[model samples]
Structures are given as structure tokens and as C-alpha cells.
Target: MNVLRVAVSAALLLSNAFAAAVPSIKYCQNPRAVNTDYVGRDKNVLVQYTACDGVATTQIARAIEARQSNNVCGAPYNTSCFTPSGGGPDPNDCHVITDALLYDSQNIGALFTLDPAQNTSLITMTYQSCESFMVNQDNVALTYCRTDWASILDNLAFNCQATQNAHGGLSVATDQEWFIQVQHS
Candidate 1:
């Protein structure tokens, strides 16, 4: 019994350490436009914000929390959703993403920045992931069977849109310079 207890305790410690190593990513929406119908389909206008700097991440979290509201909207397909909180054109909205393959940039060593014009590939990936999350919010098994595939595509269509529409009315020029990209040697 004592040996079993020790093994269980060791497992718990290892699990905690693994959890600690995982980064925390915050998903925040454009507060002004929690959900928008852009190009004839409704999409949750959200962004994935995170940082390598602990202080900056904490500050961003606080800023978002300060503006967060409990008001849930039955949106897209009558599902409950929360309002997005963030500063309008706020500096805190920008966070660093490490090990990113940025497009059209001379930088190397895996530094990625959100460039509205040049980072089309990364943007496409983000949109795809967001749509996946929206469609599988309940963690349901997705099927590609002929009859179900159409409905799945419809959900993806209704929930996904261009990222340009998600940025609280910020122009492309502004978004171009919004994030600070750094490549580490």
C-alpha cells in the first residue's frame, strides 16, 4: 500500500509539472464587435493573444478581465457566447508568438508577427483553427459522411470569415505595424 501511494504521488507531481510547462493562451474578441456578419456570414471576431513576457501577459489578462461582461449572447446558431474584452487599438492587444514562419520577412530563427498583408498563410491557418473550434465547441465527433459533410460545411461557413473583419474596425495599414516582431539568435 505504501509503495502504491508513493507511485501515485510521483505521478501527480509529474502531471503538475507537465501542466505547468504548457503555455496559457487567451482568446479575446474585438469587444466592439463580438460577432459580425461580414461577407454575408456571421463569425466570432476573436484573436489569439499571448506573450513570452509574463508581465505583459498578466497586464493583458487584467485589461481583458476589466472589460469582460457576463452578458452571453445566443449567437451564430443560437449557442451561448460571451462578449470579447480588450482595448480599442490597445497596445496590450499585441502579443508575441514565438517560432512562427513569417512570410516575406528577412527574419529567421522562428519569429512570427501578425502582418496583415504579408502573413496570409498564417492568417489562413488561424481562421481554419477558429472555425474548427466554433464547430466543435462541444467536442463532438465530426464526420465526413456525405449527408453530414454538407451540414459541417454550413457550420464552418456561418462561423468563419476573414480575420480582417475581426479587428474592431482597425485598418489594414494599422494592423501591419500593430505587432512587434523579434527574432532571437
Candidate 2:
């Protein structure tokens, strides 16, 4: 009887420990479709919509890739074109700030709007929280799509805090004025 009691106690302790060790799953919001006019205008373009909050960078990269191609007629590449199709303030001002086709492996790319006539301003795209990071360069706002959470945290941690508000959207805030200096190629 003593041995059996000890065995049962050990089993219960092990079970409790194992239960406590389990990690809870974290949830992120889905991506949604915004700027449908851009999708409608282009026949070759595809849009995968979801809630902007908690979207992974890999998904954004896929959406960007869906709009990219080499045979398409464009200025950046006559022989090849690797550009994403998303509408913004300036229809002709958006381009991949990272290596054109290499964004797939890199899992992130910075996009900017170049108007050269206005001071940098935050361009609002009501589609994704990722776009909220956009800041106008000359006159065009700089934008980014990222895949890695760690990298995102590293860059935005210093000044930005992303929190889920009552409206079920991610809101980012900074302690003071926010400014980001990005180099373009």
C-alpha cells in the first residue's frame, strides 16, 4: 500500500508538470483586402485579403510575388520586371527597395514613394498594420512588408509599440516624434 501510494503521487506530479510545460498558442489577425480598385484595374494582379493585424511576413511576400513578373512591360526591367502591385498615394511611385526578385528569400522588402516636392509624411493605407509604418521620403511615403517577427521587433521596438485596440486592429505608438532613415538603391 505504501509503494502504490508513492507511485500514484509521482504520476500525479509528473502529469501536472507536463501540463504546465505546454505552451499556449498565440493568435494573429488575418489579412484583408484593401485598395480593391488597384486589383480591378489590373487583370494580371491577384489580391489575397485578410485582417492587417498579426499577418506574417511570408504571406505579404507571397502577395507581393503574385503581382511580380519578368515578362511584364515596365521601366525597372525591360528584359525582366519584379515589382509588387499594391495601390498607394502615388500610382507610379511604389517599387521594391530591396533586391527585386530576391525578396522571396529575404522575406522582407522596403517600399518608398518618391515625390521630391513634399516633406516626409506618414501615408495611411487602411489595409494593413504593416503599411502603418510608412513614412513619406521626399513627398512619397516609405513603406515596408516584413516576414520575420524578430527583425520587426528589433527595428520597431525602440520607438514603436504595437497593441491590439478595442477595434480589433493593431495600433503602433511612439514616445515622441518618429523618424526612420532608410537607404535606397
Candidate 3:
């Protein structure tokens, strides 16, 4: 009972703090567009804004929070480990992913999960085991940054096929995962 009370109090305090920190926001027909413009502007400027059609105030706050959490360069989907909160581009979290902006990035606005990371680790372990076997036999570990199998081995390692192939300096069976090229490697 005491723990529950403490939890409730903590929740209220955090909620209030979040409410205080967030900028003034409104829901409108084009909240997504408005938000895009707002976030893209110079940081010195302070302005309250809306998002695209169906985007809600909550989502706007959530997006801002996600960006703030990243606290680094680039927006969600454009960078790694940064998952955009709220679904896709709309203010409405309920909006179907396909209906999102053509620029919709962030793993197709899929929520971040550990599966891809785990897959990469698994594939890397397998590759390493193979490497050890080959190296013990006096074979040079032949590899290319082949990202073609990034998503297969670990979605987080590389996004698209192009990213995989062009992932300069990435390991094949070494420190990094070379999942697709496992057979060839």
C-alpha cells in the first residue's frame, strides 16, 4: 500500500514535470506538417506548433520527447537507436503505418525492439565461431562489409540493402556481423 502510494506520487510528479517542460501544442488538420517545420527550424527560435492531419497533442509531445531523449544529431529513422514515439507521422497514434508520410522513416515507424540487436549478436557469435575454426586451420578470414545480410543477421546493423553494401569498414565475420555472407565468408 505504501509502495503504491509512492508510485502514484512519483507518477504525478513526473507527469507534472513533463507537462511543464513541453511547449504549447495544438491538434489540427496538418499537425505532422506543422511539427516537421517546427522541429527543423533553428534551435534559438521558440514557437508553439501543430502537426499533420490526425496528429494529436500527445503524439507531438511524445515525438519531442523521443527527440529530446536522443539528444543527438538527426531525427528518428535517420539515426540509430533512436525510435520515434507515437505511430508514424500522424498526430493520431492509431494511424496505419502505410498512411504515414512518404518520408516516414524509423523502421517503417515500427517500435524499437531488441530482436534485431539480438539477431546481430547471435549471427556474430556464429560467425566468430566459424572464424576461429578457419583461423586455426591457417586460413585468412576473407570478408567484405557486405551489408546485404545486415537486416537478416541484425536489422539494427544496417537498414536497407544499399546501407549494408556501403557500410564501409564493417566486419564480416570479425567484430561486426556478416550474416548474409556467412556461407561465402
Query: Please, what are the lDDT tens digits per residue for candidate 1 over residues 142-176?
Result: 11121122233233233222322221111111212
TM-score of structure candidate 2: 0.19
Worst 10 residues of 1 by lDDT: 176-185
Q: Select the stronger candidate by lDDT from 2 and 3.
A: 2
Model 3 residue runs over 4 Å out of place are: 1-31, 36-50, 54-159, 163-185
Predicted structure 2: clash tally: 12
User: Against the hidden reference, what TM-scores do the models get?
Assistant: 0.15, 0.19, 0.13
Each prediction's total of clashing residue pairs, residues at least 3 apart in sequence or on different chains, is 0, 12, 12
Instruction: Identify the candidate with maximal TM-score.
Output: 2
User: Residue 32 in model 2: shift from native, Å?
Assistant: 25
lDDT (CA) for every model shown?
A: 0.20, 0.22, 0.20
Poorly placed runs, candidate 1 (over 4 Å): 1-76, 79-81, 84-132, 135-140, 144-185
User: Candidate 1: which pairs clash?
Assistant: none
